[model samples]
Target: MNFSAPTGNGGTALLRRLVWLRFVAVGLLMPGLTIWTSPVRANPHGGSVVHGDIHIGAGTGGHLQIHQGSANAIINWDSFSIAAGELTQFLQPGTSSAVLNRVTGGDPSAIHGALQANGNVFVINPNGILVGPGGTIDVHGLVLSTLDVSDGEFLAGGDQVFKGASDQGVTNLGRINAIGGDVFLIGKTVTNSGAITATGRVGLAAGEEVLLTAAENASGERIFVRATGSGVSGTGITNDG
Candidate 1:
């Protein structure tokens, strides 16, 4: 026995289905499902002393310890990311010492752990910077920026000028405390949704360029944003917490 399928409308529907199937077969295949997670970096990797007397070593429990012998030091890293349950510390000469850490890689610096220093710590990455929910920063002074400052300006030590065209900004979603010092966050867009405590001052500036200078008095402004002629739009500085 021979069986025949429905014709007329059924034939039209069958033709349409065949055409659709052919079109899909010739078209680009649907992409496979992809899942992405943040890279787990236990410590700051690929660090090299760029300018100053500094030593990098590992401590117990995968902690990164940087010993800076000079009053001011500059260290460049391929990437500076600390995973949860990790700590990165800087032991400088004293509370007056400072260390500049620049990330040279394409990825931004992710602080998902603990970052502590005895003196001042300056971190610059044009890509962007994120202090995650569990991250913590404790230092005498702290400067986190998406702008760029020349080595000459940093080594000179008086007033450091940071200027860059990077649209990537700096965000803090963790805890930051500066003991008897100031905390400055500079970028195209600066945001703080975490806790920030400073004995001196806390400045968040969003602009193309900014000048950081020592406060004339103990209680004064230390960050000055430059005018870009066109002016900035929207809320440049956001503090939700």
Candidate 2:
């Protein structure tokens, strides 16, 4: 049975079949091309957010929420900046985990900013040093100094270490109960608006030598020195309420 479109009897039927064949061929070719050209979408099933991937928005921001799970966040840059509406939780690694790990490029990649955890805070700078866990407050940092806190009721258990060769005394207006370590005042000026009461021992050193200031003049703006270690130097001082 030879079917010809010129006879016009089976012409309409042939046209319908031809149209159906073309449609099927297009359907087969489209799916493979589409899959190959599209961008990779996120797989949010396993509670894993990989690095090297960036998410952008229209001036609003992005939110990442993990419920009842641990978080391992790392930022190794010259300086990491955080703006409004950013919250992170670490279920594990209170003092053990190095959340603020050092950058690979040594001192060249020093970090600077205010890091405020749920209970504690840690602030650091280029020429200054701080070592302590923040207790229920924010840790503020400057360009030339650093601060650290440890052993508090509110903040988690950890060893905060601070170091610097600056010549300015640190003013602690907030509550910091230094359980261990020494209060080092290598700086020339000594003034504390915040209380400098130590729980363990305090050590004052200056360039590989133990520094001791003798009989500073009170009337001529004497540089006050308070050491709470083995011996008490000054007479009984009143604690301002």
Candidate 3:
């Protein structure tokens, strides 16, 4: 995987200035325990080159690059895992192709974050791109999956031009949600049994004020408060719990 931004793209140069941030974690190793707090840990920026295979552990998240100048990454892992907390990871391939795989499980392993990929992300292997029941992809920004045809902008597969074969597909049996950015799932084949919420919002907006309560009535109909609008014209209300 290689990333070479076009000239005059100062924003990408600024992205390089984020410094090599190390992610540290402290928690249990159980499957369901949300015990890891990744506020502090060591995540390695091994190099700025994509040699062949890339591997990321379940302990900490790192800022990695490929092809020297290209910040793109090609990871070949036996297993990838992450717990919970504000453990964020940024896997940027820009215009390059990136690979993520799960080797041992018919059920896809779980990863936690705002797990992000800044460029066209590729999920390849005999297993293909499969997200299991507990797996989730929290897309706070751009999310590129191997589920659609590539347009050369944010996705780069499915055309069989850069990537080798198109026999592999993507299956998301988990959750993929958008917090503040667009969500794009690109692959030759896509099967989504989970939820894909691109509403761009969760509970409330930033700096919003809420003063309400939930009370029960004599009929026991589970009465709850519902409010939407702050003097805005198209203030919509969506109730999904």
Candidate 4:
């Protein structure tokens, strides 16, 4: 399944605000001027990295980009925050895993590939979570983001297993209940195809006002009891088979 930002002038403003709020949410003050440079790498064990900074490393099978702001500060970064001269990693020799834990930072941080967060975490992207072959991301706290299976065919072949391995091996688990925001999907063109299982209420909202709770398979499924002050009274979409 995929989720996309509604196109038009209205979406443009929302995207801009989201981008700006993201920067402030993490306390990143970029120079008024854009810097076309790579971020400094940090060696947590070597103290080569600074607190509240992002780190990039090379890998054989893939690449790992870690952003762990200060221990006291939050770690927030937008997936759209693009840069040049950035190191692009390819497949590593062995099945490698990348983990992005809050360790001690902010509310939401953009993590690519296999990742793990221990503290309160938020993923702010139309399709925030990306799962690859041998790629498994685990979260101990709230995972306010969308989960995606990238290149599923190639990652797990046509079957649920890849190279005799279970495709479900690359799973994204949200240990804590998700808070604010909605899960988003990504694709060239968004389509409603994935299944979302929420333990909490699911419905819609209009500026803190919940208006409807379409069918279960309904795209843009929202949980807005907080806004409406009333709960939905219907059997949400479900699979009978």
Candidate 5:
């Protein structure tokens, strides 16, 4: 059954099959190919917050719900915190070219965003994920992420968990609490210094070094902490919350 360029009763079917295969093959190898759950876009106006692989939005100290439509959320503030009763997710799956799946914030812990989610708050940045020194994540649901996972609750068994491993790294120096979920952080290298209060569990999976510290949670839970590897500075899971 030579179907490369068949010319028989099954030629049309063969051609269709070949075309489908070619489409898939090209989708995997093409340079400018895009695959996403929705059409993700960047902000028409630019955001200013930045640090390494992290970039934040203009939070503005208002209750704004970011739908992951055109750009990553860059939270900013003047004096108050931002409140959002929605889950911030990526517009689509990540590609190295346009990994539009990251959430960053202002420095000095000035920007505080309160998030409420039914499932998981996802940040699937292939470049890298970073929570700055002045950033804050306050959520009441699972934070499903591929790299940096903190500043919120991480509920387990949430829908469409993005466990994709990033080559860069995952670093956090803020605060996180999983009131009813698990905050799972997976990457090549992971660093945690702020605070993580997980009602379910807190996980850190890294390839090279994993830096962390223990702290007391809001509920008076004293958890031990430590770390391994060279680049990391904090002690192994020592509780300091």
Candidate 6:
């Protein structure tokens, strides 16, 4: 499906940021210029395994690791963020293992460091999700959304449906690579001005309700979004890179 260009004030702001980033690339740094940076470190805090058997550990120098024993795991976090030099690693059982990370502390997640996962990783934050300029994500599969999915539906292990009323959106200004997997970005507004490499499909859906079909082959699956329904107007999707 064709995604229209981003509209509304949010879209305008994103375009402006993209332009400013271009200026930054040319070594144009004005005095007192404000740069966007995450206020937190790379370590993810206040995380608990809510629906699976997992081990959480910390290492020196702002590193966090999660070892999952279950095929599907659900983790709830008060806040999930990463700074420029921090790292969060996930060790799953296999490439098909999936982890759902839901942030409930009414704050957006800013990922600016590195997030490495052996399997699929889903991050849901109603406030929003930002992958800043220095951020990097390497995973088997990745889903970054501002939508909400129920725990029952998540563990049921079929096509995952997400719905939410959040006005905030998801933005990516860094690098995301899904090795032999798909990358899905869903939100009320979705913008990508960085690099995204995936052997499978790259789906960007903007709406209140989104459907992520299960992968059928090694390539990946599809993403569907209801764009014209009531209360489903969004800024749409923008990819400047």
TM-score of 4: 0.28
Model 2 lDDT, full chain set? 0.23
Any runs in candidate 4 off by more than 4 Å, and if so which? 1-53, 58-61, 65-69, 72-113, 126-135, 146-225, 229-241
Candidate 2 local Cα displacement, residue 138, angstroms: 7.1
Candidate 4 clashes: the total is 15
Using Cα atoms with residue i matched to residue i, what is each candidate's TM-score against the true structure? 0.81, 0.26, 0.35, 0.28, 0.38, 0.81
lDDT of 6 by residue, 1-241 (tens): 3222223333332211111122222111123222345367456778978988889886567888899999999999998898889899999999999999999897689998999999999999988898989999999999999989889888887877788888777888899999988888888777777888887777676666777766543433356654332233334556675
Clashes of each: 0, 20, 15, 15, 35, 0
Question: Which candidate, 4 or 5, has the higher TM-score?
Answer: 5
Kindly report which residue stretches of model 3 are placed more than 4 angstroms away from their true locations once superposed. Answer: 1-88, 91-127, 142-163, 199-241
Per-residue C-alpha lDDT of model 1 across residues 137-187, encoded as one tens digit per residue: 999999999899999888887887788777777778899999988888887
| Tens digit of per-residue lDDT, candidate 3, span 20-118 | 012111111112212223332222222222333343434333432222123334444443343333233444434343433313333222343224444
lDDT by residue for model 4 over 81-103, one digit each (tens)?
A: 21122222212111121122221
Regions of model 1 farther than 4 Å from truth: 1-37, 217-219, 233-235
Instruction: Report the poorest 10 consecutive residues by lDDT, candidate 4.
Output: 161-170
Between candidates 3 and 4, name the one with more favorable TM-score. Answer: 3
- Ranked by lDDT from best down, the candidates are 6, 1, 5, 3, 4, 2
Highest lDDT: give the candidate number.
6
lDDT of 2 by residue, 60-175 (tens): 22233222122223223232222223322222223222223212221211111122332112222232222112211122211112222221311232222233333322222233
Better structure of 5 and 6 per TM-score: 6
What lDDT score goes with residue 171 in model 5? 51
lDDT of 6 at 49: 81
Model 5 clashes, total count: 35
- C-alpha local distance difference test of each model: 0.74, 0.23, 0.31, 0.23, 0.33, 0.75
What are the per-residue Cα lDDT tens digits for candidate 5 across 53-151? Answer: 333344343333333322223222221222222122222122211122244432111122333433334444444444434445544333323344332
